[model samples]
Target chain A: MTSGLFHVPLWIELVAAATGGIQGALFAAGIRDRRIDVLGVVAIGLTVALGGSLMRDVVLDQLPVVVSSEWYLLVAAAASLLGMALQSVLTRTEWLISLLDAAVMGIFGAIGASKAVAYGAGSLGAVLVGVVAAVGGGVLRDLMANRPISIIHVGTLNAAAAGIGASMLVLLLRIDVPVGIAGPISAVATALLRIAAVHLG
Target chain B: MTSGLFHVPLWIELVAAATGGIQGALFAAGIRDRRIDVLGVVAIGLTVALGGSLMRDVVLDQLPVVVSSEWYLLVAAAASLLGMALQSVLTRTEWLISLLDAAVMGIFGAIGASKAVAYGAGSLGAVLVGVVAAVGGGVLRDLMANRPISIIHVGTLNAAAAGIGASMLVLLLRIDVPVGIAGPISAVATALLRIAAVHLG
Candidate 1:
């Protein structure tokens, strides 16, 4: 267990990981100009699924849960492979890709913020960690692919949406709200903002 | 003290950080085509100076010395700013840049391997950490600049030289060599190898 006071349910965390893997794989596959091989694509997918967790644990000075737990790696790898297989069929479904991306960002952001709160970080610090965790993997992906960092280059509200979600979670925890209630609210809010931005544009 | 068994001297670590800062700033400034602002150049400089140490500490599941020690940040930032100021004068001194780059990699690699050994990692694991610590910052810099990763694309012996240095340190430690002696030897060996590759090429 991560902590006695706060922990995301295993199934919920797994779902988030799975979606992250799929979304990352699909995103990597969409980059056709680069000479990214199959293995490269899969690696990017795994980064999306686990890189943020590794970064979060490292920043907190703890062993990464991704490395310690066998299930996370196995699930992420499987989901990444599954995503690769499905990419051809889903190539045209841009909305679905956007939805998964937003959902993954939101879920990861909330989890990161909640963990920071449990670790007793100040509100701003917790929110910072949450935003990093939300966007770290995408940054890594862009780096590996030699592409511009999406959060920095795109005028989209990706990081702002994550910041809002993370801030909300931190605020909720400050008032003694249970993590269970606050976490989902944070995730949904972030996802909606992101989705709204994309749809409106 | 990082550990009772082994630790790099504060002065030695500072020198490495300073060199890394200088090298990183020079490297960033050389990319004239990119629209990197002054702050961007300095941030990249800081990344090269501290990113590897951050990665190494995170992998070892310990708090980053770069964060905990005031000296590291101060020295790195000052060195980065100094490097930026000297860029115009040093623009033609390509050899100096390469030398600093090699030396920084070697020093960081040796320190990382030595720390992992002190932390009771296996030989391979220690060496892996060393290579990552040596090359991690450069990778991040390239990523930020939207360039192909230098270590991966350059076909140089950068990673190999670092691996050789780290492995040598691990071997010396296994035979009960004092870290004080082993560390410098490792650093020198890595630097020479890298320098040879550049000159010979």
Candidate 2:
């Protein structure tokens, strides 16, 4: 099946969506404790999913992928809805959110870097954009939800994880790996690194 | 006279700084009402000054102007400090806050568009970046302070003001107005348009 043939890339993006959703849900839930509403939650969710890419595109002087790619919006929204629906499930699996958060942060960073390279920017520029894209969404999400951002917090290896993932993705893409495949690999690297750091740090 | 030699541009930027500070203060004050602390207010002030320019730079793959230029950070901090200090004095005059907000918003937007043009992007891209630069700061400020963003609010002329200012600024740039002179002229146009909009709209 054509779907089967594209399964790897598709699955990776979906996983990204799921992770992003969970992150958004956590943000919303945190704010809900302070009495923020449903609309605010959705905005935070959507922003966390697309904010970095939007910022990336704005910086690059390109048409915003957030506005241009319909899939981006759909997948992000679907993922957040899944998060909202599974709130009870997440509560029981406390460790899962952290794992997913790490993974999502990594993949988004990798994708941002890889895409920047594909667009013909320098490797260094790609790396910087990657990190920004990775962490940026979460930053916006937290801000909107009225929570302190995760990046600036002590003992959080967010930038470290994003840097490693983005660097790996850019290197892989530079060497000519199909980013569709290499992208997920970098995401995993990012997630695993974050997890390791989370435990170690 | 020292005042005469001080020139119009210096006075305008000072006015701009005071205006921007009040708006930043208002947003930070609102966030404080919701229980965020001192760091939250500082972050919001920075966001109001730098968010748009940073957004524009990151997308363009350049080091953000906020980081590269002393003026951006200095002005933002000064405005924020001014705002924090005068919050009580200005709070009673809500109309003053509204007017200052309108003026600062307009000026920033014009500055963004002009900067984008200087960066060698296309006209349309410049216009978009300009608008982003103008409003990006305030939107980020609101989000950081945990308040409602004006961009998504109904019947808000936020973007419209920036768009018009951007168009004018971009148009003037195309005619080759010196970059230094263009910034203040465009800022004035934006400020006037915003003031007009408040009365007319």
Worst 10 contiguous positions by lDDT, candidate 2 chain B: B1-10
TM-score of 2: 0.55
Stretches > 4 Å off in candidate 2: A1-18, A31-33, A88-90, B1-137, B143-201
Tens digits of per-residue lDDT, candidate 2, B1-201, equal 011111124344444545666577666765434875666666666666566667666654566656765675677787777666676565464566667767777676765565555555566656767766677777776666545666433214555677777877777767877656666677777777777766765
TM per candidate: 0.63, 0.55
Best by lDDT: 1
Report the number of clashing residue pairs per model: 0, 7
Model 2, A3-27: lDDT tens digits are: 1112224444445555787677655
B1-201, model 1: which lDDT tens digit per residue? Answer: 123666667887788789888888888777777565565566667778877887898888776677456588678878888778878776485777788889988999999999898888889999999999898888877776677887888835888999999999899988878888889999999999988878776
* DockQ (CA atoms), all models: 0.15, 0.08
